[model samples]
Target: MTGSLTIGTLAKQAAVNVETIRFYQRRRLLDEPDKPPGGIRRYTQTHARRIRFIKEAQKLGFGLDEVADLLALEDGRHCREVEEIAGHKLAVVRERMTQLSKIEKLLVVLVGRCHGNSGKVRCPLIASLESATA
Candidate 1:
């Protein structure tokens, strides 16, 4: 590769779309290269790496704000800070899983009731939902 690449090449190398790169630039998460007189701007490997980092962080459930925070600490000097973020995310995921488990159990009970019924004109699931709001 050359010293720098065009936005399209950077996007291709980063496995992201051009619009995503533009959006990141608009969000101040990425730096937009200066366009020379009648010439296209170019991106460097640093830019590509930043895009990949943001994408990977997002995949791990980090929001844009969180990703920016992580990016600011990307100098590889804040292990403890990174761990703190990961810990909080893990806690949130665990709480969500617990809630989902309860919901799953409730759904199973409702579906089982529906399957076992032969006489009741009122659906137990519907009745439960309607009564809960009333």
Candidate 2:
């Protein structure tokens, strides 16, 4: 918030846990400041901003490794590289969405079959699942 902050303060500012800050430091996503003799390590608003950036990227389905790549290209000179990475992620998301849509259609059909059953035989949903495994 102010000029300098501790790790806890930085995590609070970034809306993450203190351990998350340390993990980021270990992951090389955030820089760990040197501690003075008998004193605590200080963090800056810049560190908080970096954590927020990592979090936002993750919320958009970027893994930590991908976030690391994005961070490496944060300098404005690498827009093309960033765009390529983002385009790839978008393609993955689109494919996953297509798969999910197919799953949803199958679920709808299975539930419909279950509803139409007269309760005189085995459950349609269960039979469908068994057949799938078979």
- List the lowest-lDDT window of 10 residues for candidate 1: 122-131
The estimated TM-scores of all candidates read: 0.56, 0.59
For all candidates in order, the CA lDDT equals 0.80, 0.80
Off by over 4 Å in 2: 75-134
- RMSD in angstroms, all models? 6.9, 6.2
- Write candidate 2's Cα lDDT for 1-134 as tens digits: 39799988888999999998999999999888998989999999888899999998898677999888777777444678778876886777886566566666668876777786776443344554444346
Q: What stretches of model 1 exceed 4 Å from their correct place?
A: 75-134
